[model samples]
Target: MAPIRTFIAAPSNLGLKPPAPGVAPGVRHLPEHLQQFSFASRAGAVQTIYLEPPTYHGDIDPETRMRNADAIRGYSIVLAEQVQDTVRAGRQAIVLGGDCSILLGCMLGLRSQGNYGLFFLDGHTDYMWPEHSATGGVAGMDLALVTGNGHEKLTDIHHCRPYVPEQQVFCCGNRVPDESYVQLIRQSQINYYDLDALRRFGLPATAVQFLQLVETRGLDGFWVHLDVDVLHNDLMPCVDSPQPGGLSYAELRSVLLPLLSAPACKGIDITILDPTLDPDGRYASVFVDHLTGILQDAATAVL
Candidate 1:
């Protein structure tokens, strides 16, 4: 097989979690998480870029329980530049994120390429508005912001609001969503599939549905977002917010392997897993093996 054009981006975790109650997340350890992921030797990756985060990572203001929007914007600017370079070079950008908040930067990068879609593989809806978000962590509101539902600082970054249109975006593997999110999605076109539905219909059917959307929409390509919290707590529990039920490694591979192989699947970002929680590297290794295995297979299939 020929070389798979993959650029691995490692960003800081300052953009990790929201200030939800009892959610003292450690997203800052993402660099460590990337270091331990032995994928370069196995996944056939070509290049890796270490994007630097600003000094003011986590919030200093406890009242807001979040960093200033200016800081968030700063980090995204740098992150976006990196992603843009990766896309412009016609390579796949595998962004190892600071948090889901950096998803904004990823979409902005893809927008530079063309009209792209998103396959949000996460546990939570992440569709809350800033006012409704209890803890001001942008992670909680990144999806809402990107979809043009929140404040301008994030939504209008690079003046690319509604980063991916609702019709082209799909939020799958969801196990948790607040009432507000439920109501919003009910009236919207964003495709959503909860864990129960995924289990019942299975990944093969789900992948076909996703591909059909791409074909019908005539999308330029699609980007994927994998928040590790989507994995079951027992199999992978080092994330900032650990929900009880989720997809196991085998289950995730079943869904991911097919999606990654699609030519229209342009890029991907993996987020929410924290290395600090896993002292023994047990969960971290699981994350790497599944990701690399699927990536390798995808590259091989295309070759």
Candidate 2:
């Protein structure tokens, strides 16, 4: 079988916590965790180039939470370079993240290539506005920043306004959106499906519908931003903010495999899994195996 290049990078440095010296609180030894699993061998994937930058910069300035986005953007540029090179080489990217905030860099890197949609699969909507983001938690306003609805620092990266446009983006599997943000969601043009809506449509139907939309819009391709918190709290409680209901591991696997296998899915970012919470490393192992399984399955199809 031909080698399936997976350009993996770690950008787990910009969350809600204060800056530390190493991996920070929520993300510690992620790349090492995956390395031990030997998942690349199991999945028939070649991690051509793994970019793991040691950073401890998730803190938002207490006095400048809302204004700190530019600072974070500067930090993101480091990882963005790795992401850009990986994609430009025509390889699929598998980003092992520190937090959902790393998403800004990944999308920015892809935007440099051409227009691509975003598949935001998370437990929370992460659609908070800047004025509402006094705490300066980039993870909370992830979707908002990408849509050019937040402060200029994050929105105008490389002058790529609205890094991922609302029209080409589809957010699914989010069960929680702060009460105040619901109205904003309703007003946006981006196609969003909450957990309830996904359940009603069913995962298979939802996957099919999403792919159709990608095709209909004629987007260059699409990138996936996966916050493992989207999994059931009982199953994946290692994330920062735990939500109650989510897709069971099996359900997410079934849904995600199809999407990843699709030709237009250029890359993916997996975030929000904290090893400190899973002292035994069981969760990280399972998560790695699950993702690798999907890639192996996709590789098998072509083989």
Candidate 3:
């Protein structure tokens, strides 16, 4: 039987620093914007689960030094519960995000089920400590937090530290050059693949290698965290942090098709696309078309 797809709406931008002082990041509107195109129906979602986040205060928490720190922690806990329920009911979850930090909740929820691997595709590495962060945005440090490298409150949720082990992680698409924190990921056990390496390795081959890592490690499943900023700036400039080099839509599809087609691939969370930036909605339309088409193709192959 084909698995039911559940659209999990996680419209929380509390993880990012305000784009302007006292102004919250506009990514909170991503879910509704995508819905304008019937994203749920087009993606074959039978049920939609919406998880509300705490209000965006745009202030750094004294305890964690990250913007809306406790709020993000609370929201993550709730999001995890929703994910656990969807998985228990034997449905595939398609998580829509307010920012990349939502990956914390998705991975935390999957941890309760069994050991899982992670395929992190983003334009930046997103690995750093709060002290190293100039803005104290969790969205930029999510990879570090998920791998159990940050504050105890966020990292040790439900006493499950390192939600997804670093060794089982495959991080790709980082194009940032000469950033100090990029070196942090390089020193970690996580398999790192930069944009240049991805092109050199070939997208299809990279996807195969990720799958092999998941299968050989005896993981129950794996989750894919795709920050749309991984798409070239010309293609997807609506992200909170747009960068220079990234995959084209065709390149993204080439890599995602194989990863999403695998039965062991549990689910994926799409994040960091800010609707406010794309006022005309043209970018959202293209993103929806490519993503839904990929989901459809993956479903067909899986069945």
Candidate 4:
């Protein structure tokens, strides 16, 4: 069995300021700019590396925001280089994200070894490219960028055309997706388990179905991207984008437990927690507890 080598790649600049007021004071000392989880307790099972994003205060012009986006992309490039080195040494990579856009670097790291499948869990379909995104947030364009459909610097990371192909990618728990993004998803042939469909078929069953698909494809392995926004905003209110009718915390645990128990799964990225919104660390504490359990279970299975 191999050790679970978890790397904490924190992309702090990509986080949106907490919508709720008066919470920023609590998180002023955290270097990553977010109060995600403390890796101190899991220190034995993981090798943590904390990578910082370029500094950017959210109050800026669109041009400045775009420049900040470029800086983030650069940070991700450096992250990719480091991750490539880690994987080359036969370790699994777990990226603790500042935002979903960090997927670009993780995918590049995995792609350097060989192509891998992706299991994207989010409240929205992040398929919008630069041309299609109305908000122009790089996080919205990340999935498209990784699959070779967005901005040049992002798509061209790690000397690869795209990190993963459309057929090999699957998105689950999307309740709200832009119409144009839906059209792109349809044309690209990416598998999607929309919120309605997931509800209709319970999460455990859906996990089984998805695992069957992976088995059928004979994929190298699949990376799991767990965006906290996939959970109901009541349970996870700290994200940049909060959507209604998302999965319950228990439902998320159900889905992840089985997936992590499987040996074929490789790597994970947990994203979208903005601690500034969590006034008393309530949301962050719940998320951290769940994640700690997931990592522990996965490590135990391997051991």
lDDT of each: 0.74, 0.75, 0.90, 0.69
Per-residue lDDT over 1-303 for candidate 3, one digit per residue giving the tens place of the 0 to 100 score: 455789999999988988887788899999999999899999989999888889999788888888888888999999998888888788889999999889989999999999999999999888897998998999999999999999998999999998999999989999998757588999999999999999999998998998998889889989999999999999999987777878999999999999888888778999988999998899999999999999988888842
Tens digit of lDDT per residue, candidate 4, span 107-152?
Answer: 8877887767888898877887656755556667777778888656
C-alpha TM-scores of all predictions: 0.90, 0.89, 0.98, 0.85
- Select the stronger candidate by TM-score from 2 and 3: 3
Best by lDDT: 3
TM-score of 3: 0.98
Alpha-carbon deviation at 231 in model 2, angstroms: 0.2
Predicted structure 2, TM vs. truth:
0.89
Clashes of each: 0, 1, 0, 0
Q: Model 2 over residues 66-112: C-alpha lDDT tens digits?
A: 52455567756766777788777777777777677788888888888
Worst 10 residues of 2 by lDDT: 59-68
Which structure among the candidates has the greatest TM-score?
3
Q: Please identify model 4 stretches exceeding 4 Å from their true place.
A: 15-37, 57-67, 177-181
lDDT of 1 by residue, 1-303 (tens): 433556555555555443454454566667556667765556666777777666544563443345556777777777777777877777777777668888888887777677888888889878776566665777877777777776677778878877888888888887875555567665778887878877888876787788888888888888889998999999888877788888888888888887888877777888877766788888788678878888888876761
lDDT of candidate 2? 0.75
